[model samples]
Target chain A: MNVLLPQPYLLFLGETTEPGYAKTAFGLRDWSPQRCLGEFSLPGATVSTGLPFLTPVQARNAGARAMVIGVANAGGFIPQTWIGALLEAMQAGLDLVGGMHARLRDIPVLRDAAMQYGRRLIDVREPPAKIPVASGRRRTGRRLLTVGTDCALGKKYTALALARAFQAHGEAATFRATGQTGILIAGGGIPMDAVVADFAAGAAELLTPDADPTHWDVIEGQGSLLHPAYAGVSLALLHGSQPDVFVVCHEPGRDRVLGHPDFAVPDVLDVIDLTIRLGSRTSPHIRCAGVSLNTAKMDTGAALRLFDRESERLGMPVGDPMRGGKAFERLVKACLA
Target chain B: MNVLLPQPYLLFLGETTEPGYAKTAFGLRDWSPQRCLGEFSLPGATVSTGLPFLTPVQARNAGARAMVIGVANAGGFIPQTWIGALLEAMQAGLDLVGGMHARLRDIPVLRDAAMQYGRRLIDVREPPAKIPVASGRRRTGRRLLTVGTDCALGKKYTALALARAFQAHGEAATFRATGQTGILIAGGGIPMDAVVADFAAGAAELLTPDADPTHWDVIEGQGSLLHPAYAGVSLALLHGSQPDVFVVCHEPGRDRVLGHPDFAVPDVLDVIDLTIRLGSRTSPHIRCAGVSLNTAKMDTGAALRLFDRESERLGMPVGDPMRGGKAFERLVKACLA
Candidate 1:
């Protein structure tokens, strides 16, 4: 179901040591800064979103309507340690928002507290009750999906940036979020990963339904096609979204697939080629528009040169949305084209 | 959780006119005849399993331990009209078995009746609660999967035949079911389609875990790689099963994907190639051993001739599992090789 999250969030990063786990908080801070009031973290949590650290009461007083549980932990479970903080947030006059696999209402104490406080406990990961199987009918509107060479790349960032760029160019565009972080940022989306396997493609279709001919649904892609564990989700999204143009998201010099030691991250060209080959099952004219290089780990001068070299070599736009400049502008133009 | 079904089931076709909807009954009669006692259906049901029709009382008296809801109607819901017959079956001292998306227990009347009668209600479509994400670790056993050009071909039949053939040749083999019908016949399986999208591959891994190096897991496949709606489940099974050899199951006369008129059934070669390309991420040595031709609609003479021609063209064994002969034997041998 499309979750209508209350506005102005206080991101809750509960006892998470890894910065990677706190990506949800950082994503909101980076992409939807206006929606975020401040950050809240439990004791010993090393990660920070760089936003002002505010307690629930303080953030609520500052007009934060909800406290978003922003740490995407390994198992997507609500840790027992975080229960008190969640209850406290409810007591402090804020609704609770969660994107984890675990439901916020499932926690009895938190559920009771939310009920007592008359607060909403919105779970974004829960899919709608009745998603039909995909029709395989070609949708009318244009779509640009940002696929990835591996997980946790720049796919979401690229889609958000492209959607913004399209709007700046006076084009009708919408960022179709497919994951928890993206959904939280965009305020509503199908958590494609959480949907039943039978309805993965169907959910994608629902997320980006037939829009105006000139409108572009910039869908945020999921797992890599070469990823052994998640290629199914990726393929489902590819066929269902049926993107006319796609951007390959990759991280430079990241040789191995994250969490999968035996597998190597696929080349950007390989990702592009495979996406087109499989995505053509639905969108016959699907083509790679660009490469979204996640240059967050690379030196600026090196990243710039790599983008140029890759663009020339691949004959496509290669740019980092996080490092938007002339290259990103060209990438945006290519997507629109 | 693995289901332990009570043996010798009475196939229940509940007012189904279309033979296609009663495929589960037909499939059971064809593949697991020994486990079936007789057929039962509501009044006005045109479909039959060719077994002697018996009332629940007669079937129960005839040694039927369970009444299997055998009509796989659209939407996988138990029709309201069939509730009286189901309650009657329970009263007649038979446990109810269902593979529909709608849980049998969810029907309050039937749930209460089942509880009062002390009869088990088995819902095979429900997946296990603790399916982990795929580790992508190469498992020990040899696996042979039957892939399809489209849905409802002979994927399950091919896998069942191959598993039997492997056992006949003094090999250690197991038929692994991935769908509701397959699970019912096999008495257990992870309903791959019912699993959360994030854990599809993982559930598959659980379905076919590490085994003896010489053992073979003959995995029943699901949808086609080119199928718009169900390809996610197909890809997940492929990646998770990591089949060393796969048989392409295709219906000879069908041109379009079932229920999706806009999409043509993918070529067997394309299915093979795509399965290999995507499947290689998990099973690096994955390859197609042969083709399983569903030639039920063709005359015997034409079917044989066509098998030989396609075998020659594809440079692999081609046979109809239902029409087992030298061709089917060759296909089985090639799978072992």
Candidate 2:
């Protein structure tokens, strides 16, 4: 399925707002924003942060057919002050898509303007109307998960890399994004953590719904087995995905669980063992497929050495996925072979 | 706090319907009929279910201050045909409470009738307004969880028993239910399973909200660790409760995971270990404090013998909670001490 918007002129709204959407803005820029004609900000912007800033008319002149509210604010709320600018863009005949908690469609003024102008106002964060409670069915297919030793430690990056590797190997594979960053990258996904706890797995199950039997669903994991604040989300994902195999994602030489010093990150073997057993508690077929190390902290040589050493220890595939190593690719081939 | 209704004068509506709310009806009767004036049915009922059947006026005459719509229908829908009788009850000054998928308060006709009579209409299955994402805080004071091998294997009963046992010992303990049956018994609780998945744990956390450090919270678990159809609920509950200790509730001699025969019940030790580790993944202070065996399948002697053997194996107190055994009480004491 075509998940991302087709090749079309785009305008990013508020790329330079106070308390900037650094994450969303950086993601859009990385996704190649030359495709975006320019960005729109308020009147008095002192510095250009690389990307060109424009007004509504200028954006329309640049052939911008769509406007993306490119900021994820605290609680996903869009300030009322941005409404006038958004309305002006809508009046300029550009459809709008936003990932805000306060739905643009719920605002009568903007919704009415969109209706009047025959423009679409899409809220990316709108939840599915219905999600069946997960059955933990051990469904057929090579479903792989990227679990982590800690949160923000390369689970999403590993999943994306592996999806690319699997596709290159002439296999049917899909990257199932479960977080905001991955969702932004993949173009469409239920922000798993943003979802209500009961539906976290349901969302995962929905995202990875019964595909072709030969297809591999590389689900992006969230939180960590050891994260004090957010482990429930991980547990739900683990159970919901019911993956046949999983890849452990970890940043080498991490002293403690991310954001919490009280919880120490355990050995890679402990993480693997914990993940495999937890994943299999309901669906007994689940196993740890391999390990993906995020060795960004180490030099390339040290990272490679650590990968080789961990590979010997795990006996399964292991590698720095970002560096395009052989270990994770081998793990995928071994599972699908 | 008063969990059950105070000196309830209840009228059971539709006691003899084709799709009988036999479970609910039986539960209410078991809770005691002296508490219920009688039941109401259509005029010509074939057989009596012991509780005297009454019409609207007859129910009011029997001192029925509240009318309970008693059919736990397939979809929990109160049929349109039953609405007239319910309106009649409401008009007769009887407050209404129902456990149904469709909220009676949301039904305009019933809502209007309740308003006309100045009576309270309650939908027991309604979820909490907002449940914050669980932070997995290792809070002080003891929190005990009742996790079962399968659904309907007496997780609720074990929790209730433990709460009473703790209260009898002059300790402050509360029974927090996560299902309809438990809510009916508790008078108030967010139905965790029925809640939107995102809010399941939040609901649990809300129910057992941070209380006085000296209070023990006995949380009634839902679903089971092994049940494929509903393990997500179990996992969410495990993380949401963040219990200092947990009690394993299992029905001895059961070969399968309740309804799904394909999934066999695993060893008690496996369940205990998995529950403890999963619960503490985020909050490391949690542990398995004891085991409560639903030994209804065996005589007291056999049950005690099995408990003793299992207790010795696990090195924890184990017993049949219903039979008033010492193991469960001792387990509570050990955890709280």
Candidate 3:
């Protein structure tokens, strides 16, 4: 009588594949099936069809009683001290814990293994990151938007030109449930109301259901709010709905430095302080409020004068959420200067 | 007393998430508890948490075996025929089917339910279309060569530049051994000499059991010969090394007017033309020898001047296959004239 059962979750493969476990750890755009249960294999190991080879001891024996891996990719870009050492090795859940030493001073072996693994770390706490706000009232205040470039690039023309850059700022930008209310939605929070029906149902369109609108403060997160499920949905929307201004969008050709093998040379001020540590991973009342770019591959006036001189050295508006909100609210108070 | 053992070959995600499984027909790929095995109730999907919202009989009453449906736009590229009609309707021996009378020519009401479901019809055994060969190469002597692609974009950089383009056309290629050759060896098959040792592990880097040189002639297939176990190891090296000349290497991009969503595009030219429409597939002193092209995303001098003016409108010289062997014996007497 021995039962246990729970495994099947080792994840990884970022940069488009997620039809949420598209048939065992992603494959079938190029077809690689033999066996998979909760996959993360990333064709880094065989599959053109020499069936299920896996091995990191078969990904610690077929990953899934949980593991998520994919630290983006230095090629596509990763640092913030490699996502704070993979969120301090997933909150140091043992393997001798230790993490978050800030931008890891140019990796001195992950800064001496975060000073002997921050004494077997653990405080899996995380809260403070707000900024979702528009939860209702906007018929006169005005807001509507969408943005993209991951999950097969350009999130539906950056979320329908971010609802026509909030109905070109005269006000009331609409799309679903008319006078709309709020719904930001990126590659995130989509229980579908279009972001192309939540990226063609990957992860089964995130469990499918969303009328949103308690006047609509939807916003959304994931493709990388310093990631780890965009820091677990910005600390579950700052312990549930405190948002006000966060916008981040981006593509000064993947934040400067190129000839791309996916942007290798990064550091235009460490990718504009990794786009303001993705709004300082939520909670300084969460104020980043501006960046938007995906000009297909730049030159929109030299990517808005090098993203308006790096949103004027991050203080933050480089603007054009498909153009409006009065020049994206003067590029969000010149990026909240 | 519960003995239902045969529920093991599973798959499912949508026949409206299957419950008393009787309706919704197929086209699958959503579900991932490590490629599933039994018991059912999946819905955590992601790209920012999706799927989970079941209803279509509360996702077939959250229980037992098969389903995976999810695909919405793969033209702009890659959805793989809605994941082979939902893993042939969630796996059990298979049947899903195909399309055309010209893709139901403007969906005339699903072309009368595909002529009353002529066995679910998939564009009738695809990616194979061209045949007529018999041109040169056989002085009744030489043997094995295999090279590939006549279409499926860069099959491992044209099978390691057709093993250094068959040792710069003097023959002798090598890199043999196949063993689960999928995504370079993570236990998948990364030793064809460390897949050409670099160039991003191309011809499975010459199938290395290690230490090279054994007078060439081995070759093996790549992009795991569109995998039904490397297309039965490329149909047992095209029927036990009768080789002589299989070089193809495809993807000269567009001109087959619309339809290359690549699962090796109808997977390796529709299951390696069951040995080129049987005559026990080639080597009747083999000839359709050369084709190469991997000029990475075509325009190889405008696809060799549109295949030398369509090999002079089919009077042969099947377009500059490096031109001669008497213009491929006048393009094999204008392909069986």
Candidate 4:
């Protein structure tokens, strides 16, 4: 579903203390800094975007168009306690933009206040009304998908970085977002997780439609094929994308699937093998380009050595997109090739 | 989602002329005959369930408690012309049961009439309000899933037949439905297709929870793993079911996927291999029990010969459930073992 969010958003961090929960706010601040005015938070929220702190009234005075819900909790619900701040945002002449599983319009008070203040309440997570089943027909365009060994990895960052890299090389490319944070960053995208199971692949197909043969759609993936909770979504995204090439994103030292303790994180080689096995059903020439390693927690020397070892072991480029270097450049080159 | 569908249904074949479109009605008549009272249709509808035809008032007088929308088109929509008959059925004191993409309660006139008459309008395709992501933790009890090489081959029928066979052998078994027709026949099930993409597998986990060690849940599968349009749903069902044993369902001489002319029907062996490869992620001991052949279009002699040939080639029992012969009995024996 495409959304037209008013620019210069005031990020709302509602009672979130963990930096992980405030990833959306951080993501926008990092990627779309020009569009982010400042940050707003509830009383107990300790997380910050490192941007100027602004309340709804201050944000509105400073030309902020909307207050974007910047924290993601489990179940994607809008907590009852957050309602007052949301209403105040609308009262202060700012639109409310949410990417949660729950609809802002579903709350009676919020809906009434938005109408009373003549402010728009945009729910970015809502999918399109109609999405047909995937046709599996090969479309024009070279595409690359960033799959992961587990959820909450750097799939979105890798895709965004790769898309930028392709543009730096003077190529036609677009960053196709699939998840909520990515959707907010890209300004418009289908929330694949919110779509009906039968139409998931179709929604992906719609998200990245036919483009010029040289145009590269660096599609951000969701979940993981090895993830116990969300393999279906991953598979759907994989099939619908039919990427000519794919990159595996992984975080070092993660032994188990996030939140799913019963399942072990799959080997990167197994992920590549399975991706090729299933992805080839749609794109006959689907192949892995390289690995996008998340080395945020690693020391520079150790991360470099691990990258070299992994590259030698897997016979492909391995690099952290966040720490762009020769390795990242090589990975980017492989994606284009 | 479990539903208490008022039994003794007046099957409403709304403006349906082709028998293919009325598979839901035919399924109920054939499988759950005790719950099906009589058939009802619009003025010019030509299809019949080979049961007595009754109008709304006649059906109510004949002790029909519900009017089940029995026709399924491409989009699962209720036609504008058919709304009159649905309203009439409600007015006649019969609860309206529908398994379509369109909710019966969404229609203002029908909703008003249902409230006025104190009747229920049940939309069976709606998923539960909350579903957790799959844990991928193994549950107790045996599971036998019937997967297919293409859509509408006999996955549901094979599952239903196997459930009956297990009971006949003095074993506890339940037919777990995943589609609308199967849900109506079994009286309750999660419509895998209707669930959100991220929760498809999770919903399947909810469908067949832990049971007694000896009990078997015979799950009716959805689309084919090789099906371009629906492989995601098929994979979700496969992973979530984590079947101890699976039966590959295929129709002889079928060359292409239904409704998808661009893709060819996959070989049964490929389906078995892929199922094992993916299903093994969740079900470590997953094995192909046998093959369920749909020989509805083949002559008896030809069907028998094909079954024998396939059994020899696959090194497993192969039989058509509709033909309860020695081959089918052998297949049933293998399932129990």
Candidate 5:
């Protein structure tokens, strides 16, 4: 499907030139990226902060739609602000596509987990439409929550906590709709066989199915390429509930959240904005919540630094800081304002 | 495990004692008329219906506990209330379990589409704690919904919908915790395999392992039974959101709502009043949302008439009326007031 990327997109097209990325590419049906340079035009902003010299400059020079990637290993999770900056940059209307290592074998944890879950790991030549309901009514003023990292790195808890926080704030927040939950419904009841079947379903259904868990059965968005449920649920709940804002909590998988670290965490800031950019339009009042990697040997201040740096990087205000609960909460109010 | 029954309680004694009732005892187990002779001396107000003939004295004299058991038919799906008059005559508590042969065999159509789904013959055995978390809460001055019925009738939906309606009405309710939502947190998550794998080592973060659609996994409530996640989510929301008023909804099932007609339906009023009966001290103030059957039928007027007849037979004031909406709602408000 033609993924409608938001303007001013900044995405890295990593070893995508390789066979792995191309094999999964939709448009590259019979052909690969090598056969089509500048043959396709970006619908929006595309930024690449990871590859500094060779890839970014080359793609830009070749008029293949590009922006440079950046990073730093400062925060625990990727910084949310950095992604915001990239999104702001994209508003100038760029085409953004995410790129990374082509071979699954190259990524250890990713490979095994993908196999265990029975999902695919593709280059996503043409990103799937995360926002399935593309309508004026569908996108505006809808409640949105970005959850579950591509790698199950504790995103679930973060999503639940934030959902609670939202309810605390009187906003109806739920665990972002998930694929498994949909499958559970399709499979006739929660996964009772799940080792912690009871616990998982309990957590999800605790607040009344719709109240506790966002509807992801038919919507799409908010997950890696493999599990389409993430995207589907996102679309469904957003269509159904239609809240006023969107908040994302993240722990960048690599150093990308801050923009210059050697590691490869998806920046919380960029990812959140990329969500709307890659899939759907969030209410302008849309707010993002960041859960930084505060402990992983990075400076405690690394998360905050990513904010300031990304502000300079992506071009949005140092989106209000949520220090622990205080800053995070204030940011929500700010978004509402 | 010892099934706890009140002392001095009435139960069916022997087949010889009640010639017609003799052949009716379930092969699995049945209370004897001899055993029924002694009431389980439960401390509190006697289960009086103000009808002298309904007195426990005569019931005890008959060497039967003031117990009521509905007659069964070889056919299928009997409404427990069919024996209303018989129950009122003895002013006894009855335990009658029944199932649907035809309906159970039919497949469920969602959004009303058939063929895409396959139906299986379903038979459920009635087990104790059917309406598991029926009454009693840690708090007071708050309204409580007292669910009265054997298992698999309308308890779950009654609890959930009543709880939901209360929340809708700005009342803080919990199915698991006694509150506005009248929703119960029984049967935690299904404890499916998919859920176990997902949480454990991020096996795709899938929720539960698969199960055959035709058969149930039938385990005695494992996975966070003591501390349910459903209750956890709802309670947390209540704690954070703090609603007003609590009205419990009670749904009657096949054996109860559509129970065998041979026996007179129990005083519908009393069956709905079960939570209060059990919670004698607070019986006067508890709010009951006499439930509409989900897995049974959806006739508000009919269900209400059935309940009203039971109440009148037992000599209680006739209820306003049964309704899917406003009619039942009026009674709910009056009870709390």
Candidate 6:
């Protein structure tokens, strides 16, 4: 299913992860958006994650009719300071969309302003539809899951990029989002973390329900097996999706688990093994198909080198999907085959 | 908190696990029951896990004013076959209580029958009270958690038994239940698995709110790290409770993970390590205090031998609480000290 938003789109990328936003916004810009106006961020932000920041007036001038809250925050709360800018965009008659835990429509002033301005308020964190409890029943279609080394480390990015690449190759592929950012981009999948625990897996199952036997359900994973704060969600996704093939996603040059500095990053092989073991609970034949690295922080040459090194070490297809190469696509084709 | 049930109780132990029901009923009978009139099962049911089967009329004759559904079924569904028996007891003017996911009131016939008879339909699976999302806040008190090798291997039994032992030793200890059976016995405590995944831990944190600094909160555990069907709940409980010390509980003779024969039972030390690691996400200094073996199936001599072997190997206290011995109690005292 396609995400419906008014066009052209203005993405709000808070100063946090500029490169991550740029990748997500641009990724969606290519796949879903009719046209991209520009990105927005706090003033004096040095990071260059997504597209360059556009003022609310500039966004209006660019013919942007929808404002997307693109920044992914750890706390998930959209700070009050961002409200004034959002209100301006809403008044500009741009429909508002956000992936934050705090709903945009939940803010009384924002709701009233949106109502007055005749603009839609979309809370992407809220499931677009009701989700059912997963039966853990075996389905006919093949599923590919993007397991990650840590949160915000590009599991969704790899899944989305691979889905696009698979479609480009004329294969039947669907992207299943399991988190807020992915839900915002995918336009229809449930936020697995926000769901009741029992249904977390069920929601994942619902995303790619009743597809052709050969259809590849590319599921977006959340959290990390090695992540201390959020492994329960990750495990639930692993068991729920019951992916036949899983591509391990990681960020190069990170020695610590995300948001946890004291804990050393686990070996990628260990993460792969643990994920497969956990995934095998629901699907006994589950395997690690490849590795997708998030190398947004590195230069293209260095990123490719790291990719090749990991590829040689794990003896699996490994590459940076953001490198604008067919490396990840090739891996996806082999795994689905 | 103690579970207050209307007397006299007639426990419904179906054909599933007679030994299981007998154990659970007898455990509660020892801890909280005013008196267990007798256990009831279908006629011709050979297993004598608990008290002998009593017909509804006979149960009422024996002064059973309440009928407790004693079987722990997967998916928590009370089958239609059992409804007839339950209805009979309900019409006999006995109150009804069950821990199944299917609430008794949802059955129209049962509801009407119950209404006609003025019987109280107590669905123990329902949350007894409102639960909040866990704040992961550091509250004053010491919590001793029961981390099991798998579910229904007697985490609650060990916890309740240990709590009683602590009280007998003149220590300020509270038994915090995290599942239905324990909740039914404890009178109040959140059903951790029934809770939303996000708040599973928070609900656990609320169980022993504002306790004395020196008090020992012996929290009942649910599920296991190795359990394929229910590990997410286990991990959530581990992280939410933020126990100062965790006691690893296991069954000595079990060779495979429950319900998943393809999976071998993980090492007890591994379960302990994983729990400590997961629990430390909220409480960094958390430690595995000891091991509690559910050796109810073994003879006392063999159970004590296995306990000795494990205690020697782990260099920690290990014992069977069901042995009517003080081995586990001494371990708890030493760990808390």
TM-score of chain B of each: 0.91, 0.83, 0.24, 0.94, 0.30, 0.81
iRMSD values, candidates in order: 0.5, 3.5, 22.9, 1.0, 18.0, 3.0
**Inter-residue clash pairs, candidate 4:** none
Off by over 4 Å in 3: A1-327, A330-337, B1-161, B164-337
State how far residue B124 of model 3 sits from its true place (Å). 24
What CAPRI grade goes to candidate 1? high
How many steric clashes between backbone atoms does each model show? 2, 8, 87, 0, 147, 6
DockQ, per model, reads: 0.87, 0.37, 0.01, 0.76, 0.07, 0.22
lDDT of 6 by residue, B238-285 (tens): 776778888888888898877666667878988877776567767889
True contacts kept of each: 0.89, 0.28, 0.00, 0.71, 0.18, 0.23
Rank by TM-score (best first): 4, 1, 2, 6, 3, 5
TM-score of 5: 0.23
C-alpha lDDT of candidate 5 relative to the true structure: 0.30
**Which has the better TM-score: candidate 3, or candidate 5?**
3
Error of 4 at B122 (Å): 1.0
CA lDDT of A198 in candidate 3? 9
Candidate 4 TM-score, C-alpha based: 0.95
Best by DockQ: 1
Query: What is candidate 1's lDDT per residue for B122-154, written digit by digit as tens?
Result: 898888888999999998989998999999888
Give the DockQ (C-alpha) for candidate 3.
0.01
lDDT of 1 by residue, A1-337 (tens): 4656798999999988899888788889988999999999999999998999999999999999999998978988998999889888989999999988789888888888887999999998888789989988887889999899999878898899999999999999999999888989998889899899999999899888888999999999998999989999999999999999999999998999999989999988888889989999999999888899999988999999999999999999989988999999999998887
Q: Which sections of candidate 5 miss by over 4 Å?
A: A1-144, A148-241, A253-270, A277-297, A311-330, B1-337
- Residues A1-337, candidate 6, lDDT per residue (tens digit)? 3345466778776665455544555555655654566777777555543455678778888788788876655676777778888888887778888776678888898989988988899876675454665556677888889888877788887888888888888888888877666665666577766766656666666666667888989998887765655666777777777888999888877887655576667778988888876678778899887888888889877877877888889988888777757677668666766
Worst 10 residues of 1 chain A by lDDT: A1-10
Summing lDDT over every window of 10 consecutive residues in candidate 6 chain A, give the lowest-scoring window.
A16-25
Error of 4 at B316 (Å): 1.1
